[model samples]
Target: MQRFTVTLVWVCFTLATFPAQAEELALTSTRTLAASCAACHGPNGNSLGSTPTLAALNQQYFIQRMQGFKDGSVSSTVMHHHAKGLTTEEVTAMAAYFAQQPRQTPQPLPHQSFLGAQ
Candidate 1:
């Protein structure tokens, strides 16, 4: 009887921690996926040029645009390919991550030339 009670307590404790573990794993995966966007979107979704900024965007809007891109309803030079590769859950997670970031103007890169002059 005592062994049974102890086992039950252990099982309950393990189950209680499972959700937290899962949540952490999901966040990590989302962050890893989002890191790829930095190539053009800039760090934390702040665009360095004409590309649209992703930080602080409305979550639903982000999701909708991504879905559109995935479905080929939204036109893009490259986004359709990228969007089509992501799972819906990944898109939702990335949207949430970007929405929570604070937007910042990106600084020009060192040695950047302007107006055809250095």
Candidate 2:
């Protein structure tokens, strides 16, 4: 019984400290694949060009937007070429990549309390 307990502890400890290599690998690959979009969008999906920014979008929002573009639900001749080229694997990677990026917080307007959701 004591040996069983000790082995269980060892197993749990090993599992707990196992390096999170998969996440790192995924991020590296995603960063590479998503690099193509960074010219128009800011690095890591922070949009720098003349379109709606993608940084800070919730993961779900990023996925939805990418999926829409892929499916033609969102129409844009300029974006179509880029979007159509993306595979589900690439889109998922992009969503994960952008989700990991730092989000831009809009500066609060002074007296926003008075603005009341305007």
Candidate 3:
């Protein structure tokens, strides 16, 4: 029937749009939580210099480290305190967000040579 076909199309359209909206909401939630780390970890987990980069770190490793920090198994001047503030679900979301980020390739250090004369 025409009505049945129209109903099926409407259902499919609604279902397709729901996932995109859900994904956007999840991303927003993750970003909101990750924003707290921006000062040290850089935007989206890419560190600038001296600080260790978190971008593209494996999800399991990130989760494990965060859990360790939260539990006092890992020692850091600030991370432990910060980690303790996040819930397990928030930690998982943070890990997933950072793991999805693209990592910057390390630039090779420049070499220098000195001689009195050549």
Candidate 1: where is the Cα deviation over 4 Å? 1-9, 107-118
Model 2, C-alpha of 27: deviation from truth (Å):
2.1
Clashing pairs in model 1, backbone N/Cα/C closer than 3 A: none
Stretches of model 3 off by over 4 angstroms after superposition: 1-20, 105-118
Give the alpha carbon lDDT tens digit for every residue of 1-118 in model 2.
Answer: 9999999999988777666666678778888887766677766566645766666567788778778887889877687677778888888778776777786644453553565675
Clashing pairs in 3: none
The weakest ten consecutive residues by lDDT in model 1 span 109-118
Reference-based TM-score, model 1: 0.80
Q: lDDT of model 2 at residue 29?
A: 82
| Predictions in order: lDDT | 0.92, 0.73, 0.86
Which ranking of candidates, highest TM-score first?
1, 3, 2
The C-alpha RMSD of each candidate to the native structure, in angstroms, is 5.1, 10.5, 7.8
Each prediction's TM-score versus the true structure: 0.80, 0.60, 0.69
lDDT of candidate 3 over 48-118, digit per residue (tens)? 77777888899999999989998998887888988898899998998888888888765555767876586
| Best-performing candidate as measured by lDDT | 1
Report the Cα lDDT for residue 22, model 3: 99
